[model samples]
Target chain A: MQTKRMTFPGKWLPFALLAPQVIITLIFFIWPAGQALYQSLLREDAFGLRTTFVGLENFVRLFRDGAYLNSLSVTVVFAVGTTLLSMTVALLMASTVNRMIRSRSTYTTLLVWPYAIAPALAGVLWWFIFNPSIGIVPYMLEMVGYRWNHRNSGSDAMLLVILAAAWKQISYNFLFFLAGLQSIPQSLLEAASIDGASPFKRFWTIVFPLLSPTTFFLMVVNVVYAMFDTFGIIHTTTQGGPAQSTNILVYKVYADGFVGLNLGSSAAQSVILMVIVVVLTVIQFRFIERRVNY
Target chain B: MVENRPWANFFAHTVLIIGVALVIFPVYIALVASTQAPGDLLRGTMPLLPGSHGIENYKLMWQSGVSTANSPPAAKMLWNSFVMAMAITVGKLSISLLSAFAIVYFRFRFRMFFFWLIFVTLMLPVEVRIIPTFQVVADLKMLNSFAGLSIPLIASATATFLFRQFFMTIPEEMLEAARVDGAGPLKFFKDILLPLSVTNIAALFVIMFIYGWNQYLWPLLITTDPNYTTIVMGIQRMTAEENPQWHLVMAAVVMAALPPVLVILFMQRLFVKGLTETEK
Candidate 1:
């Protein structure tokens, strides 16, 4: 909230400067959010006629609904799976690349570009790789007598989406992990090594603890990414199918409202997702504030 | 580095090599698939190496996409994607710069309320309230147009915050000097602020370009017309066909992915700066 010590002399100029963003935000973001809130409290009969007020009934029903519960659990699993897989791999690669003097930038250049790939494209790439009949992985899996069909199997479909989502995220996490590693005082690592500890022991005891802030920040971010941003990944690959196994909450909102025409339920779902995002954003900002002091 | 252990160095290199290989594996397969003849991809005979049909497949998709999918040619889709991305990047940057300049440079009434209103955009992503947003767009008759594709998405809380943070670092004396020199608010903003923001703008340009180019669901929801189908969503339509031609699809995928990937490679420093500095 700090402003310039010296100020610009303006009454309407500032408003003019802020108009475009404020207008767009109001029209696009605030208005729709308000509409969703209002609509969540109302309901209509099956033929889009005979409306009635239903306060919290949609939310109450969603908790009792089997599909909604499944979507919630699937979101948790996908978020945790993506965060863990990408962070672990990125931490490993970051630590290894942190050691190399000459090859660090080269390795980084190779690893970082995937951050640019669309989630939809990443899904297609992995979907092709895991294609049952023609994919190389499935062909290899068959030699070991394991079927890899995602089209008919829920678990396989889940795994396919998870891998695709995690793959796109690794580059983003790696850059953060690398930055975190670089910021750690090398003197501490050198002193720990001089204590006759092995390299692995030094990493576990010293480097790992120092990277917690970055780890926590990335964890929240990855969760948000998995929950909301992976819509494209799921849409392109699974379409929440194999019996709605990969139907995360965001997709469910779209599906239920737009596809199922269940307006009240979708509005309620949207409100819930908004609450979750607000909570996560607050948590992320809180961690960032705490990280500054550390 | 503290110790001279050769084995440790070897282990590090091995891990990095394997990590890089895993990262590159899917794209490599996509590349190989694009180069293969259509028949080579079926029956578990997918080749490990590139085939002779690379040019043929890319040319086919670029000229006339797979007819079965009813998707437009890659050339048209890529052009659409470029226009959408540029519109979004330019829109986001210009609006955010102006708003941040307003917030930082002026003392005004209801400023805090306006700031919080802007902050609300972060709470509800396009996904959560997508239905109502779609309805709004429909009522406004923005469907299947560039205005529908980019404008709603241009109000960025992150970019505004980024510019605010950067503007805060500018020495206050610079503003005082401008004021003393008889430079008005618009004069200072146009001459002084724009030049100072060039680097931040370039950095954010890379990130926003990718964001706009890679959009799938928004375009999918709004633009039912094939004319406005972005490359990202267009490829999805291609694969949703009854008989997907793997060769042409991969070719389309490669083309769709190339622009943003190349942008990152070329402006890596700026992209990384924009990305790492972006979060909260």
Candidate 2:
């Protein structure tokens, strides 16, 4: 909210500067969000002839609906799976790369370019790698007499989507984890080492605790990412198939609204998603403000 | 200087090697697969080594995509992606720069309200409100056009905030000096503020370019026309075939991912700066 002490005296210029952004927001963002709210309260028949006001009915139906419940649970599992896998791998890689001062930039470059791969492209790459018939991973699995077919098995599909999503996210989490690791004061590590603590002990007692704020921040971000941003991954690979195994909430919103023609339900789902995003954004901002102090 | 452990250093090196291999595995496979002939891929497990058909497959995909998928050639799709990404990057950067300049330099009425309105966009991603947004685009007849692809998606709160934060750190004396030199608001912004913003703008352009290029859902919904398909969504179309030609598909995938990947590799510092600073 802070502005310059010496300001430009302008009445019309400020409005002119703001017009383009405000216009786009009104048309694309605010208007549609309003429409979603309004449509959530009305239901149309299959013929699209009559619409009746059904206050809270769409939301009430969603709570009762088994499919919606299934999607919610799937979203939670997917989000948790992605956050844990990516963050753990990133933390390990970051700590390892942090140790090698000479090879740090080289390893960072190799590790970070995957951040540029689109979620859809990432999915396709993994799909080919895990393609039950032709993929190398499956061939190796078959050597162990264990089959890996995402096309038929629900768990396999879930695992495949999770892996694809996690793969794209590792680079992002790595940079943050590396930044967090670098920011930890070296003197503390030396003090712990001088106390005869092992490297593992020092990491757990000193280094890990200091990285908590970054870890927490990345957790919220990764969860939000998995919930909303992995739509491309799911769409390209599973299409929410293998018996709805990979239908996260965002994908379900698209499916229900665009494909199923269930306007009221999809609108209601959109409103719910908007509320969830607002809450998550608020939590993230609050945490970030606190992290600034650290 | 507290201690030296050769064993620990060796262990860290081994871990880093394994980590890098895992990170590169998928792309390596895609690259290898793209070089192989269709017959080789269909015969069972794919070969680990690059095949002799590398140039052939890439040329085929670029010149004419899989006719079975009814998708346009990879060349056209890449062009569309480039155009869309550039439009979005330019649109977002220019508008955000102006608005941030306004919010920082001018004391105006309803400023806080407008700021909050822009901030509201951070929470409402297009995925949540897909249908209504689609309807709005449809009603405005923006579907299947560049305007539909980029404009609706360009009102960015993150970019504006990034510029605003950067602008806040500029010394107030610069403004006072400009005013003493008999400079108008527009003149100062054009001369002083614009040059100071160059680095931030470059960094943000890299990030936003990647974001705009990699968009999947928005283009998919708006552009039912094959002519307007981006490479990202175009890949989906190719893969939707009953038995996709893995060779050509991989070739298309490589081309689709190359630009942004190269941008990151070359401008990594700016990309990192843009990412870390924006999130804060």
Candidate 3:
């Protein structure tokens, strides 16, 4: 709420300036979210003719609904898997690139372009690589006596989606991790090295501990990303297939609402997702506060 | 000085080289696949090298898209993507700039209320509110239109906050000096503030353009018409075929990915700055 010490004296001008963003937020964002809340409390017949007010019935049904519960668990596993996988790869690359004096920019450029690829496109690329009929991975996998088909295997489908999601996200995590690594003072590493510690020991004892803040921030970001943004990855590749193994929460809302035409349940799912986002945002902001103070 | 070990440096370089290769592998495969002849991929495992048909495949896709999938030509789809991305970027930057300026420069009623209202949008992504948002578009008759494609996605809390943060760092003496020169608020904003914001605007433009270009779910939901289908969504359409033509599909993927990737590669400094600062 900080403003200039010398301020503009205006009434209508301020309103006029705020109009465009406020109007768009209301019409597109606020209004639609309001409708989701309102509709979640009501149910309509399949014909879209008769509507009955049902208080918490949709919410109750969602808790009992097997598919919704499955989606919740799938989301947990997927978010955790994506966060760990992308962050681990990104950290390795970031730490390695930080050590390079000559090839640093080249490595960063090579690693960072993937951030621009759409999640759906990333999924398609991985899907092609893992294609059962003629993919390179499967061709190689067969030589090791293991067949790979995402279409029929639930676990395989989940793994494919997770890899695609993590692959696209590695670029983002890498940029942040690299930035984090660069910010660690070189003097600390030098001092630790002067103590005759090995390179690996110095990293673990000096570098890794300092990078924890960045790691934690990326964890929340990666989780939120996997839960929400990977909608494209799942939609493009599996469509939450192989017995709903890959159906994260956001995709389920779309499938149940748009594809299945179950308005009430979808609205309820939307409300749940909103709550999840709110919680995550709060946690993110809280961490941001600590970061600022530190 | 720390002791130098040749083995440590060599190992670090090796790991970095391998990591960069792994990162580039997927797009490399897509690039190679895009060049293959139509039946080359169907015959066996995909070719690992460039084919003689690269130009032909790209020409076929650019001039006429997968006709079986009902997608428009890649040229048209790329145009739509460009227009949508520019619209979203410009819209977000202007609106966010105005709102941030208003909040920072003026003492107004409901200022805190409006700030929190914009902040609330940070939590509600379009995916969560898919049905009702689609219905709003449908009701407004904006479906299948660029306005619907861009406007709904442009109310950016992050951009607004970024501008607000930038504006606060401007010394109060600048505004006092401007006022002494008989400059009104709008003139001060135009003459002084706008010049200072060029770098921030450029950085944000890179990030927003990529965000707009890569939009998949929103465009997928709103634009059902083949003419409005973006290349990103067009790939989905192409691959949805019972037996997707891998050659054409990879060609479309390459086209879909090229502009944004080029943007990043060319304006990497701005992109990196925009990304890290925006998230912060």
Candidate 4:
């Protein structure tokens, strides 16, 4: 809110310093995004070289394509499912960790370790545990006289993907919530206890509201990560197989552009995905920025 | 304060223990699998106990060319991963710190516009621009090279955003004091701000290093030659090949996964602090 003189020597210095980052970002990020936008309007041949302009035909074709529609629905389901499950687990873990009298650091370290491993490695770990032939989970299920085949069943595949995504996410959300819990003033909880509030009542009335901002921030970040970053796990484990049940929008983009060599459609899909993310992020900021005091 | 209630304490500790076990069991299984022999691994008869064949399996993996060209060893892939991770980590850190310093300390026209320009990149997923980005890399003749793996990822908006937030928290009086001492802008950054940013730098370094190490798709897409394959790509190739040896594959995975896991374990406190600071 403070206005400073624009001619200050240091003022231009920062802009000068920022030139490298700006140039790199433009060349790699902005340029590519612009190129993708342009290519989305043009037609391409089988070998992936752009040939001619097709205007909005790619968008029109995408809308009519049932596979794209299915991918959209699948992505929505995956994002929502992972977000909700990871948030719930994170909340529980944060509150439980808050109650510990000792060794809390050790527990926190152990719990958060999973996030340090690459998502690709996490996918491989899960693949081994769920592989129908040698996976430990399927073997255990058989030992209990029930068949658990994730590869063949759509629901099972969806569950596996969600579970893998959620497992990696718990550490991220848990760390934030735990920090928020620790920062809450102890006096407020003490006063509530003195008023004869039940434990559940005190949490609901005092702690939950205070943690809302952290929760909201986590929600936005978690959803974005789930939609975009989980492609590694999905691609490695299922390759969006078994009738493409696990095919999310990001994976679809990769398949269309790289594997299928349909650059126009892929670029169009990318544009749609970008639009959805930007719109949702804007809506989130508009609403949550009002309530988030921190 | 009320005296600690034993029953309530018991319930809490039990739940925490269960959570820890659930979190650790899969990792434990992976480690055990890594130690078993090929026959034991194939038969799926190995229990959740450590085996004595870890060295043998590792040797077989090296000799079998699981990660290298024809007769080359698996160590080549590990070296490739290390080089790639190091390049991205060092590159991202320097650029992020400089950009963050500029955005925070120096007031300029269009400063916020530039900040938002970098921030917008955070929302655009790499998958969305993979084709064009790949084409650019191809055009630059960086394909299958370390430069291809590291150059495009050097400018990370998340790191810049984080560094800016960290720099903002440093009291303004410090900078003004440095200016009063006749220190130039670069002198203040080098002598004052950089020293105070050790904690943030360490935290971001660990994070960026892990991120670089975990990359699979980009490495796979960029490198066609087996000689240049990273560990993740190597593991994927192993899975795709006929008669894929689960023991060797899992061993390679454990090897690939260990460095980052150890780094996280050691920097657990800093990791938590770094993430918490970002949201703040």
Task: Give each model's clash number.
Answer: 0, 0, 0, 0
B72 in model 4: Cα distance from truth in Å? 6.4
Off by over 4 Å in 1: none
Q: Please give the range of 10 consecutive residues that has the lowest summed lDDT in model 3 chain B.
A: B1-10
Of the pair 3 and 4, which is ahead by DockQ?
3
Worst 10 residues of 4 chain B by lDDT: B64-73
Q: Give one digit per residue, the lDDT tens place, for model 4 in A52-99.
A: 999999999999999999998898899999999999988888888898
**For model 4, what TM-score is found for chain B?**
0.90
Off by over 4 Å in 3: none
- Model 4 lDDT at residue A66: 95
lDDT per residue, candidate 3, B1-280, as tens digits? 2467788888988998888888888888899999998888988677889999999999999999889999888999999999999999999999999999999999989999999999999999999899999999999999999999999999999999999999999999999999999999999999999999999999999999999999999999999888789899999998899999888889989988999999999999999999999999
- Model 2 score (lDDT): 0.94
Comparing 3 and 4 on TM-score, the stronger one: 3
- Would candidate 2 be rated incorrect, acceptable, medium or high by CAPRI criteria? high
Instruction: Answer with 2 or 3, whichever has the higher lDDT.
Output: 2
- For all the predictions, what are the DockQ values? 0.88, 0.85, 0.81, 0.55
| CAPRI docking class of candidate 4 | medium
Q: With candidate 3 superimposed using the best TM-score fit, by how many Å does residue A143's alpha carbon deviate from the native?
A: 0.7
> Comparing chain B with the reference, what is the TM-score for each candidate?
0.98, 0.98, 0.98, 0.90
Native-interface RMSD of candidate 3: 1.2
